[model samples]
Target: MCSLFRCSSASSLLLAFGMAVVTASPVVMSIPISAQNAVPTLLTSTSKTTFSDIKANYWARPFIQAIVERNIIDGFADGTFRPDRPVKRAEFAVMLQKAFEQKRVRQLNAGGFKDVPPNYWAASAIKEAYETGFMPGYPANLFLPKQQVGKFEAIAALANGLGLTATAPASNILNGSYTDAPIIPNYAADAVAAATQANLVVNYPNVKKLDPLEPLTRASAAALLYQALVWQERVEPLPSNLKTANYIVADVNQNNQTPNDVVTVTASDSSFSILSSLLKTAGLAVILQHPNNSMTIFAPTDEAFANLPKGTLEWLQQPENRETLIRVLTYHVVPRKRQVSELSEGKLKTFAGKAVNIQVNSLTHQTTVNNAKILQSNIQASNGIIHAINQVLIPPNINLSKK
Candidate 1:
């Protein structure tokens, strides 16, 4: 839905996504889904008989592992993940369908496909898969389940399944070429383009080329599935359990139903040094003291701080740029804490008082936060939670939030 930019190495991005890549912890602010939204109750798939026997070493291990963790896919009692075993068309269709339970189940006729008979075990899933455009038909109406799925076919299936596409920023077109143009099959141009724009497809060893149409390997499938979940907003690392040791603040009086906020966010204990410095510099310490005020703050990591335009931070440190800094900081916050589950597809308000329009796929964990990923989230706290954001937020209109 939105163009994606490669922000950092996997370790760096994973650190933001809760994989703990950083050593510096941020201050223990209020736990927030975005604002003081989510508090405690933390946060899908099913297994199929077709995958009766799967081994851990199978290339599908990662895909199976992720979907399994999310409850989207399951395994047999014996504990096996079959990677090379071709998925029966019906079975593959069902697995795909299960991954996107967010959309209303597509309506289905009694039967679907030439090979998928009425008695076929996967009729329902295949039908849903086809209707959703995840698995379109070939030149003929046949869906040959017995025959193994090819490479490009699978890519098309997944790209369509999650409704993801990509593009380049007008400003960053000169950054670098990331896909191989010729090898990408003609039919997959748009899909590849979409993937590239979304930062979904990265050239392996070469950013400017894509070996499109090649049979996607089992490992590749796992990588793609992980990306899809990231894209869909389904898979999020749970907020790190924080030790509530420092602040003496009392919890807000609890008369209200928790605000229906999206993106509950919290900061890392390790990032406290960086967090404190920014708060002091932004002159937001007073806001932290006010008990009645409800807020959401998107704090930048040390890396974000380091990358600021030269003298930019020093200028913001001046009185004239105070509002600019506040607007930048506020742009990171929303009114309430919203975990990935609560984000509706559309524009949302930020503390900076500007609007950030986004396209979200709640099922796949696919999210584009103004072209960046939430990376890490739901860090718990007392006042409001923090979501570690990648690119610094700079709302276009600082005055918008004031009114």
Candidate 2:
């Protein structure tokens, strides 16, 4: 008794959707400014008419090559692309313009940067970048064209230019007590934060802090653009061989209490008593009861829970680690009731607020996580659905995949 609908940007785009037979449900999904459903096509129009055979240089190789392949940018005669070289302001402006034009994004006008005089080449492109809220010049309107752009500055430009906005600070995003935010130049903070939330952070060698002022490397630029593309939903599908496990419905209340009605599995029927212990410890026994109509659990089987290191369960038993234990447990449960048929092949945003990639093999009737496999299927409960799994599906330190 449900229906699906999507209102894509305008009243003209509204559509009533048909119910999916396998899941017996209506799925209403609006297309985000993403590539998951439809990829944005870019024209391969480069300034170079016909360049000689060239090998793109490292540092800038990937991005330069990608741009060239996508026909957004190009290089000169020697046939060697110098990626480590700083990107000129003019070049960046042109790239930004091309990116937007290819995507058919709204055009932006340069409101008049002091240094980028109207007479300068690519003025419109530079202005469009600024007007689109991608890159803004200094407060006095000076466009420091000659200056080498830094990591943070370039990231900010990409974020704003691509229309990815920053979210408010999440309550649980462990910054590892990062204090670099205060040190980031005011102009770049917004960009840094926006990129960070979009998973564009591949900060290596120096993971703790983002040195906003440091000049960006060519490799870093490629990674940044790639991630920006991901944020825009230009993406890939999960591999078919990845293993997926089913979760059990342990629909707990806000207070972490399991339901009033409990289904006890005999010790003979299950292996690890971790479920009982974990539940009691999480203070969640009160919420996992009968009649949970809309919850799903990635229930780890007894043997799987028992497979943990000998001292692992015992260590979790210690009272001091209660909060940590709660998170571990909550990480396994998603807010939605997902049936097997509903899963699609790709990275999915989980109910636990992280992402997991899922791949299903029609030939095997099996689903996989990055590599983990689901051993069982829908185990229904009055309150929700539980899918028993073989291995203890530990939420990845990063996140989990939901399909």
Candidate 3:
């Protein structure tokens, strides 16, 4: 058996179980390696599965573990998963070959690219990758197998190969989801948009930063492949972790139902009785019930309304106090849809024309709006997402006592 030291010493670029070096004759060669450049082992093998560099809290750990366990990719030979390491085109091809079993759509020239000789370790993988339509070569027959694959390119390839097409305009999806949308190459925009719609794109640390031109890291690759598998329905979905869930750009068209869904949920919930009634009285329910109007509501529980100053609710309910009631209700409503994960520490302009202060406690994992803690969140509705707060948010410049 080849020892780990000897395997790491080998000059091979990552020929793992998933990215294995293959011969033209199709014989699987066994290579003994540490986690660094070795064949990715399943979780069943305790000795080979643990990568020294991947911490329990690492954002990509779940994705990497999933990919490795399925023999889709692997770490290095030094017992460390250098997740940030860039993956070359050939390496990506090998990963695609292992990760997907899509039926072949078409076959290219058998002679293959001038750059990829038959003896090349990844030659077979590259051939399969292009022939299956997952990756296409450049004009003039250049595969550029050694070149590092960019994040957008990899996503585009996956989306194209999977026959996923953008349901909406490319510009609409890109501008809404990515902060660096302007930099996304025109050629890959549609495919990337399709990939985003399919939830195959995962950005870590910051979800809005697509870093389109950045080279795809091993961690990013694993995350992407995992999502692709999810889209293909080959594996069951993983449990939602904050680190991963917040970063997945779910389908933009997911909330297409009538706004009655929102109105019904709020009106039916006993906890939101106070909020639902106030909205109806203020006439904001008309707006919330309209399918064209997208909005977010920081609904205060009935208990929160009771905690308000005595006579506050009574004063607002009076016919003379209707205007004040509208203002107060609008204060809790913000334009457009926002999930709990989208809330950051900043001022968010409310429908009342005044902004509410948003405070996020990273250490405590709590979000507060105008000092009111979010007791429950991410209640999905047709028009938007609703969050339940512990207190009613008052608009600035409103004097409840005088009213």
- Per-candidate TM equals 0.42, 0.42, 0.53
Which has the better TM-score: candidate 2, or candidate 3?
Answer: 3
lDDT of 2 by residue, 1-403 (tens): 0111122332211121111112211111111112212322322344342333334322233334444554434444344343455655555665566554322224333457677666665566667666666667676767765556677788778766654433233221213313365566766665556556555654544455666667765445545655555333343212234221011101112123232222332111354266766776666444443232135566666777677767666666678766555556655555444545445589765434455677888656577654557666544333344555666655566232321
Which pairs of residues have clashing backbones in candidate 3?
A: 17-39, 35-76, 36-75, 36-76, 36-77, 37-76, 37-77
Q: In model 2, what lDDT does residue 15 have? A: 20
Query: Which prediction has more favorable lDDT, 1 or 2?
Result: 2
Per-residue alpha-carbon lDDT of model 3 for 131-173, expressed as tens digits? 7778989888889887889999999999877767654678988
lDDT by residue for model 1 (268-349), tens: 2454345555555676554443333334455566666666666666666676566566566656766543444345678886
Q: Report RMSD for candidate 1.
A: 17.4
- Arrange candidates, best TM-score first: 3, 1, 2
Quote the lDDT for 232 in model 2: 34
Q: Give RMSD to native, each candidate.
A: 17.4, 19.5, 21.3
State the TM-score for model 3. 0.53
Q: After the best TM-score superposition of candidate 1, give how far the Cα of residue 401 lies from its true spot, in angstroms.
A: 17
Please list the C-alpha lDDT of all candidates, in the order they appear.
0.47, 0.48, 0.73
Better of 1 and 3 by TM-score: 3
